[model samples]
Target: MSFKNLLLLCSIIWLGVSCKSEKEDPGPSGPGVPASFGFNSLKVNGAYSGFKYNDVNLKPKVRFTFSAPINNATVANGVTFQSASGEKIAFTSVQEGGDSSVVITPSADLKYLTSYSVTATKALKSKAGGMLLNEVKVELITALDATDKFPVISDEALLTLVQRQTFKYFWDFAHPVSGLARERDSSGDVVTSGGSGFGIMTIPIAIERKFITRAQGLERMQKIVSFLKKAQTFHGAFPHWLNGATGVVVPFSDKDNGADLVETSFLVQGLLTVRQYFNEGNAAETALRADINAIWEAVEWDWFRKNNENVLYWHWSPNFGWDMNHQIRGWNECLVTYALAASSPTHSIDKTVYDNGWAGNSTFRNGNEYYGTTLPLGEPLGGPLFFSHYSFLGLNPTGLTDRFANYFTQNKAHTLINYNYCKANPQQYYGYSDQCWGLTASDIPNGYNANSPSNDKGVITPTAALSAFPYTPTESMKALKFFYYKLGDKLWGEYGFRDAFSLDQLWFADTYLAIDQGPIVVMIENYRSGLPWKLCMSSPEVKTGLKKLGFTSPAL
Candidate 1:
């Protein structure tokens, strides 16, 4: 029991504590300490979870972040990607990111919907000459292959899948703050009024298909209704865009900072549909019905008539009232505005407004022939396919007729004319086949334009054909097969189909818009079961409005 014995015992205890601390710490204790040299994190295609890349033609990349600065020379030899079959993938280059990360780019485009693995070998060394303790690997799965042979599917199943997936844009990827649909994929924090209306119409479809639970759907509907109750409004009409978080008006254009009658009509269409769907006896359902009713009743539709004029104006800004004085007219997508105006219980418009303003002061009639098919309404070649789609979404077109024309025949003719126009290939666009023809207002490589034969730009919007399913099921089925089976990887995405594509320009969009995505679901549901149309028509207000407008339908 000497002093030397005590000092030796103390030294042994200190060594034991030091070793335990070093072993427990996952990270390096100091710069010179030997540490695990492999990646602390790995990102395949920039995500930990498997992601469906939008562009099938683009090569996939792998990135790794190491615990310590990696040796520059070891990166090329230590990192590699291989297919599931164990074949090595050729890399075009390996580039360093700062001192701690490396990115591997593939030599060619990765196969679509295929699984691949990225590996970092133990040979990967830190700048301090320490080798990785173990090899690390991760998996990445590409999205569906568009060029694969077509698979057999029932028409009913295909339509249901399309509707459900499109509904996800509004339900799953809704704006975080407002619980509303975004104006488009790239539009941050900007929620759309009309597009959200289209989205709202699809909620029942989602619930019926079990894409979402009824409770989930109702919760989201509550969020949307609450936001609407607090959001800025002009004469009870919402603007085209709003800040998703604040519910404040987001100016669509320089002067379009106030009421939008057409957009409001679109919103009300969905709201009324929701009101019809949730008219149950449950307390939550009752509350939802009342909220929707309040929103529907508050819209001052008569105020948009511009001081008792026989026309309803499209927009009215508080800062510049009536400066952007575009009138709502027909043979276009604004027919719903007139119908809703007449249908409004609290603020209804007279039938004369429909006769004068919507019918283009009696110049709305257009009976024309294109490609051996007679278009019963609108200008030549039917003036884009959306005219048939937007209004007819909730307003059942089957056996729907007015003094103007038989809507079913008119819409069918319009879709057929658009299809035949592409089949004829008058412009000789690259991919204009019977199964690949739909021209509408959508994004183009140069910019956005409404595509038609008369105003023909080669941009083909998938929503155009898909939304026309009710009017032209046989032709629409052909287009659906082409879009889903042939061009799916390029055209479709997580939520649904991208905004538009141009085969002539060899361009494809990697975005989705609320306006385009909403109709695909609501109209497809309409085509499949006539659910949305039937529900909207069930409303007493809608029946009264149609009767006042002198319109007749089988449902009516």
Candidate 2:
């Protein structure tokens, strides 16, 4: 019981007390440690942001990783999901995320285009008994799937959905470097001038539909105009193709490295439409409008007149100088080239170019009768419907006429001829009926062709029919239903319809082209509300050019 014994006993008791306190009252991990018991990362359907479920057959899986190892009880009780309406969503299982994460698999396929909310509650605890510093909530939206039960959508609703989804190809999937439309899904860095033109016309549509805000659309427009300013040009015209990233000329062929007049005209058409659209006096909009106008005025349309000859050539390569040797004739998609050239204020063409060159020296007239319909200004069967579509996309066909024919009737007759030709089905293609009939320049089993009854290769380009919606709605609607509801499995994708489908070859395009997809959205909007035509025609230059060309419109 001496002083040594007392001191030793006291030391042992104090040491025991300190050790117990250390074990029982573990404080915060440290200042450097993250405060939340929630995940450092979270992925819904395998994407962190803008996750989309394209395949209707697949269920959605959400995976998350925590800052610290989470408790098993927290995993069981803390994670929950509700739809935008607060209705609970059942999950098949909550599994471990291997080391420090968790996975939740939905019990059923998520509804298309539906928004869902996922919540990790404050009850979620770390392995060390620390509660979640803040509850983690994620909002995700499911994309519209083709397999979803068909709701009774109005015709307008159907058209809007088709237009918006197709527009996404130009917006969401645009070229990473230049923000221009890619030539096709497979053409990695290649961008098309004509197709990009068609895409430009859809930007205003996107703004009107609220797919993007005016600021977002203007930002993209500025990028495009800025790129065009620095991009390669031949004779003040853009090439048929350009490298999307570096703004270099992408030779479409060995000799096609220079100015492409027809393609440039298409691009100018879109630029004018954009100029008309962003008319507000805001700094961003004013800058965009000025850039577009500068690009438009720079094109020397008269230079393409070929030594002031009657005919205008399609290409003028710096490497080969018109060696492609193609003429800008009518009864084809190049009508826009002539119209825009004649419309150009700075570099204008005389009406004689339209008359002798485009009208084939007054022989461009198509007096041929097919399927009891007469086309006034194109080859047999109106040369595959696009003759009616491409030019009229911005130029309102209603009340539009020259000396030869009324454009509206010409287009309608062309569509009916194409439709009737398919109904006749002389070639006995695998799928040609009232519900599926359109032949134009599109991919076939062999390759691309300008398909028509006379040139029937059994390929059906949906754009040939879809773009004709402005001309023939009833027939186009039939084709639309067949293409969407019946053939959605094969033809539809994350974007809307693929470029073309051939039943005879049992072939379907697994790709999309900017040219084909662009027309669908712009032309459909034109049919519904005349938005593009209104915007394009609003330009004073367009009015003057149309007058010079002897064109008249009731809308004017």
Candidate 3:
């Protein structure tokens, strides 16, 4: 008690003295005073770090700067710098100083007129190896402003459209087929030769690429080249589909039993014609031309001559009898169109035969009498039949500007008038037609009723025959501004475009794809640039087919 009381009184007196005095009162000396270890200083770098645009192109760079250098301490290993949005905007080059700094190179294109922040951190280690530090933040902006008149369909969007369609759906991280595999009816799912329909969806994407969004109309010329280079194939053909479980071609179409050069030819035509948009005599153009030529050569067109039909057969179904006489107009048009479009002064002689002879037969105008056999006994596949599948007519008479324009306008008007029946109401069919210029119609027949054949029911895909054709800018633009823009996310999907739009039904409830979009793209560019006309002039098939169909240069 006596010692404790004395010690307590001394402590109290020492505390009072220490508090009042300026000089330190060192209680008991410690060996080499331990350094103060705690979150004493907070530091950060204020710099905007993100991708910048040179005009519309991405300008890659790492941008970072520090507010002040760190002193008397080292940073922790796992400490990270991030943006306000919690994104890791780290610097590849980090240096500690009274002014600590880091530099980070962005992998993506930056938005114009935008700023970003950089952040840093410092950690003080205790003798126990535990850590203590405060996080820091900083920021800076790019120098370039967001005012560049770039192409409406920029590279970024193009890459995005292609990649998403191919990767997310077509190949499904597997491989794309090269040759023909399956035969698709107008309304069925476009499956592969092996009957494997589980692959990432390919039909809608193909349609949209060719038809709805023809903005980069000719840029797609390189797509086939890229596709061929990337496609995994057997015997010059592609698997019609990827098996969901096996990731291989499942053989879903009539052509699935064997290589289908006919479909390949159609695709090749699109690629070749579109290539003309690029500066001529360039490596890309030359390479594309060469690849397409090789592909055409590899195809055994003789394989198509079935049972001495003289015309190409639809497909070689392993299970069913080959799809013989059901010759689809759209497919036939592509084969002839692309072949003719690729004709050149150097190769015109061989290709021109298609233009001047049987292909030019006038019976085709009647839409009957192919190979001395009548078409499937149906009401002449009406207004929206062939036109709904491919915009071939749009690309056909491109050589004659006035005639082509007239045809295009008529075709577009017909599509507008037929699909969207509001323009032709009972009370206002004629006088009110002008009011519904941009509205597309439901696929329902003219006098559609619930009890009609299943195929007669109405269904409009957002990315249907209409949306993907970006060739007629004035018309497409008017339609886009009026229809697409107005529809917004309702009809438009996250992908580049959808299949069709439903005016009477739920917006995008049910949709299927056909080979619609691709031609739209080629046709738009062909008309806009007048390249298809030149190419057709170079081809015998086109001349022959045009003549056989009674189509003239002026195409009345």
Q: Model 1 misses residue 20 by how many Å?
A: 87
**If the candidates were sorted by their lDDT against the true structure, best first, what order would they fall in?**
1, 2, 3
Q: In model 2, which range of ten residues has the least summed lDDT? A: 49-58
* Best prediction by lDDT: 1
List, residue by residue over 1-556, the lDDT tens digit for candidate 1: 5343466467556544644553455455476776654445556667643222223334767777766778878877787778777888887545556677777777888776455777778888888777765576766655445464547688788887788788889988899888889998888899999999998888988898889888888998999999999999999999999999999999989999898888888889988989898888999999989888888889899998888899999999999999998988777888888888899889999999998888865546777689999887788788878888888778888888898889889889988999999899776555688988899989888688888878887889999999998888888899999888888757778887898987655578888989899989988888888899999989899989998999998788
| 302-393: candidate 2 lDDT, tens digit per residue | 98877888889888987677778888887677777888888887999999888889886454787878889887877766777667777777
Candidate 3 on 331-363: residue-level lDDT in tens?
A: 123334323323322222232333333244343
Off by over 4 Å in 3: 1-249, 254-256, 259-262, 274-288, 318-325, 328-381, 385-394, 399-422, 425-456, 462-478, 509-556
Q: Residue 243 error for model 1, in Å?
A: 0.9
**Candidate 3 lDDT (Cα, 0 to 1):** 0.36
* Candidate models: Cα lDDT each: 0.82, 0.80, 0.36
Cα-based RMSD of the predictions, in order?
A: 18.2, 21.4, 22.8
Q: Which residue ranges in model 1 land beyond 4 Å of their true spot?
A: 1-151
